[model samples]
Target: MPLGQRPGDKSDARYCGVEVLDFPAGEDLPAVLNHSLASAFDFILVPLVDPNYRPAPGSVLPVSASDLILGPAQWSNHVVGKISEWIDLDSEDERLRLDSELTLKQEIAWASHVSLQACVLPAPRRSFCGNYARVVNQILQGLTNMHLWLRLPLEKSEPMDDDLDKIKNNSHTSEIVDSWELWNSFRLLCDHSSQLCVALDILSTLPSINSLARWFGEPVRAAILQTEAFLTNAKGYPCLSKRHQSLLTGFFKHSVQVIISGRSNHNVFPVSEGVLSGDESYAEDSRVRHALTPYLEYIAYLYRKMDPLPEQERIEINYRDFLQSPLQPLMDNLEAQTYETFEKDVVKYTQYRRAVAKALVDRVADDAVSTTRTVLMVVGAGRGPLVRASLQAAEETGRKLKVYAVEKILTLLLLFIV
Candidate 1:
């Protein structure tokens, strides 16, 4: 009952509500059709590139030449002969004769004229190719128009002088007149004026602005103030309208916020309202840590500077405290292990040592061996697990022992030493 597949071998059943099957090359058409019927399939979606699939000779015939012109017509002809016939012409001359006889330039002009005519018409619609040609023509025409406008002088010509006077006399109308004059002058200059000389003149005038500013600084400032006043009062100007003005103000405020905050609204902040309240699902504490890392280093630098101790004393104290920390026992344990045991045990010891080594290097110089010895004292000599391990390492390595046991509980210290 699925589309395109017949129900059974019975002629009546095959004809009754079933659709016809489409087969490709190398496929056993009868077998495929039979399989589809047995499976109750109305249609099979097969690719044109499949080895078993070939469309019938005229199955894909296009309605017109426009459709046939885009793709591989030769391969298309082999698959669909009707399309080939529709597109086939005796010669290029015949094809050209069938179409308009305009050259490329004339065709462009004609197309633009057609589009301009269409634009003026009510609900004008064109075929796809016609639309494409019209669009190309419209663009070319726009460029041509612009070039023509640019050819005129910046100052008003004879016919435009009346409009210019009307604009200058009425302050309210000046902007519109100025804009129109500028645009028309630009167009005329582009089309008829010597552009190279105009460009050179423009380049030469850049230094004049600075020279004028130097000579008449107050005049420049006054002119700027007057321009601002004009813009504020320009009723017809889109940017001076209340809504647009508010929108621009909002945009400027947002831009300032983005600059000060170091991120735009779209970027995630390190500490946001939702994150602070634990309501944000994707808040990463690591990002906060990353943002604060430089600040943390700065704090540490300030703390060091403000410390009461002399530099030498601070170095000694830091080194002694670090070396005598719990890290010593861990290092001794790592050094005592066999190669196989070391592989397993050394990782933890190495991590601890590296951390301590980095801290020492940052706080004290590399030649501070006295501080290392002080660290050994701070770790203590009592027979705790750490102390016992250190003793065992000393026995194995035949190294001299120096240790200090600091325990608040007298009983535990006594038991440890014993």
Candidate 2:
């Protein structure tokens, strides 16, 4: 039924789900951010900007004020605190100077109030030829010990050169580009905090997802594997090339905790996962939900194939926490997709029905009539899933109710009514 394509027969009150906003890099600095919080957004994703990049007198950077966030004012929320990305961080002189130029006094100050997870970034090459150590040390020192994530460049190729020859003669370790030398080098400096991790950026340019496993080098593997996440640039859906899809997913069998990012428009800045999914919604459909299903199922399939969890590990993980990962928690729109009734859909909705019934019930039996008789209205009614959920809730409560679904699309409305 594709959810909203037909009139909803169910009534639900918990249908007013949470919404998160995504703010792209632009002008208006504090205003946009403040507005997002004021609107009660669960979260806001601002593009990573270098707070201290000072272009040479003659040089100009292609960026805006919004792209240059100072240390954020401390607020209590989960923020992916990222370093400011500069346009041109090429050469040793520039790299060495980074230790002096980059500062996070304000950022850390903000973090003391709000929770800043990981510093998301692509490698910050100190020179055309340096391991990730220098840039990493700079972050460690600046943030005073925070988790650092290396989002292996998805489309950009690392500079390649003759392997061992350049090492002695040219003194260039461009060879590190092909493997985990950067991560390894950083390990030598690591104090072994939960702060060192990897965020594999899935892309066609990846030489071999298989190669990454070997590069992990058992010990380093165990340490950071416990501290891993995935990243990808997505359009309406995961921007995985057909050829790389299975190979990439298979490589990270349980890495469904991927952070999906994308450019919002012509300015070519990043947008939040929420906006990307909601903007691409088909009626009430979220693009992210579509993208999440198959991947999570794939992960579950992998889980079913795994060795049983150790009792000690199981004891540490709460029943709910067992599901937490680098990925965001499940935040679905709740309306079932009617057109495609897969086994997963049936399982999902059935569980949701049980939950709604449980959550909505009260000891006051007479109140059920008053509660269920309450009119249900769904604004921007995409397909009819919310309406149906509402109806379901009302029926479960044994209350009389009328549902008014207002949708801007006449064709969609007609389809639902018919």
Candidate 3:
């Protein structure tokens, strides 16, 4: 279920997810998934393969559970696959590097086999990740439906002062090394493939406000909220700080799904008597509260607290963050459909008519309304919406007017004297 229902809101941001820390082995993924869904989480970010397994010759991949455990629809709709974190393609050892690449590919194949919508790749080990980008680019060439999200920390460390004495003494001052640069580099290398996206790991401390704002323009699919990032409330319930709340609101506006990660810090609810850890037989119902239920509840509270989206904004919500190439009206004429679309904005034309009326009233004095004439010019007047507005304004103000409509693309320039 979504956090809350707002009229005209169909954004994915309404959904919240939890990151599964432990592997659900022995065909137990269904029970875990059921419990999480019952706890009100819309989805789960789960490991596709066991974390302990390393690639070996002729050895089958140790997936968490058989593909039959969950139906195709459940896998695609409710699960986000997590690639193994141990795979580091940039490692110095050749054996480790080969194994890492193979494992990454195998896990991705398994995710695709299950028809998972998206998979989160592990963060780059060091600053330089050219090899990582190359492998991902190769994978992207063949993928038809699945999207790959490159996970990275929201901010990295950069040395502010390079004084040798302070550096040697371990007292050198350091500042954030804007992670956007890292993402920018990776995306550029991959030719900015649309299938590639970002999943930011939000820690306890956020970067400067201006630095943080840079992410709003990027293709951020999810924000992984660490459990430690939550501050304890007055009543000991989980809550976010003011800055965190503001950032979360921004994310919600951009349709970025939030995933609660890490161990449960607040003991807001007591565990039932018979439930045991790693027990698949336990009832997967609402009666058994999940450990991360408090955090999820707080997230839902934040979501519900948001004001409903404005009606006009809801109309344009589909194109909110869409990227499009610039159009050149001077070089080529716009299609008739384009002109019709803009002319259909009744609200815009109404405002234009009102403004023109006010200007006409001010230009011609009340005493000279019938005696003096006002001259109005509408530049680039495509389809004459403004021309009509000017004529209406002249009638409303009872002022004699001479109007000129100039459109460069059109062969004829219209002149109207009223």
Candidate 4:
């Protein structure tokens, strides 16, 4: 289920997910999923394969669970596959690097078989990851429907500043690589594939506001909120600091989903404690609530507390990101529907009236207000909306005015004159 029903928001940010730290052993995925859903989470990020498994001759892929354990829709919708973290294609050991590459491919193929919509790639281990970029680029070429979200850390800029100073003071010091620079290099190597996106690992302390603003323009699909980033309130509940809360709010606005990660710090008990109170028979029903439910609830609270979308914003929400062909007024006739939509903008017309009134008041002195009339010419007036605004402005300012409109389109001129 969604976190909450926001009136104008139809984005994925409404859904909150939890990361499953340990592998769900022995086909226990369904049980884990049910617990998370019952605890009010919308999805779960689970490991696709066992972390300990390494590729070998005649060895089968060690997956957490079989593909048939869940339906195709369940795998594609409620679950996001996590690539095994141990794969290090950039390692110096030739055997380890080859094994890591084989394992990475096998896991991705398994995820594709299960019809998973997306998979989160592990963060690159080294700064100079040319081999890593090459392999991911190969995978992207054949990938059809699924998207590869490259995970990157949102490191605080304090260390970056210190590193910058070291570079200036000493020629021997190597400057630290920025996360954005890493992403840029990887994506450029991949030729900027549309399927490539990012999942940011948000830490406890954030970077400078200017440094943080760079990500708002990037293709950020999810923000992994670590549990350690939260602070325990007086009531022993998990809550984010002011900066984290603001960052989360910005993510919500940009349609980036939130995934709660790390061990639960607050000692908040399972959500089923209250419902199963005094019922010993059903107490240990083997279906316990999720420990991270409190964090999800707090995130939902932040989402619901946001102000409702304005009516005008709601009406135009459908046209948010898609591109439309630019209208050439000189080459084409103005459509009636376009005029109708433009005239409905009450605020635009109000501003026009105010500007006209100010100009009238400034030009006509108090003594000349009754004797002399100011001639106002509205060039390229479309159906005389501006003409009406000018007349209304003159009436309000108590100044005499003469109005003339110039329009090239005969159809528009006739409509306004009539």
TM-scores of the candidates are 0.13, 0.40, 0.82, 0.79
| Candidate 4 wrongly placed segments (more than 4 Å) | 159-165, 171-174, 270-287, 325-418
lDDT of 1 by residue, 243-293 (tens): 323322222212110000011122222333222112324243333422212
lDDT digits (tens) for residues 215-254 of candidate 2: 3332221111100122234432223344444543333222
> What's the distance in Å from true for residue 417, model 3?
19
Worst 10 residues of 3 by lDDT: 271-280
Best by TM-score: 3
Give residue 167's lDDT in candidate 1 (0 to 100): 71
Please state the error at residue 230 of candidate 4 in Å. 1.3
Cα lDDT of all candidates, in order?
0.26, 0.41, 0.85, 0.84
Q: Positional deviation of 5 in candidate 1, in angstroms?
A: 56
Best by lDDT: 3
The model with the greater lDDT, 3 or 4, is: 3
Prediction RMSDs, each to the true structure: 34.5, 20.8, 5.0, 5.1
Minimal lDDT window, size 10, model 4: 273-282
- Identify the superior model by lDDT, candidate 1 or candidate 2: 2
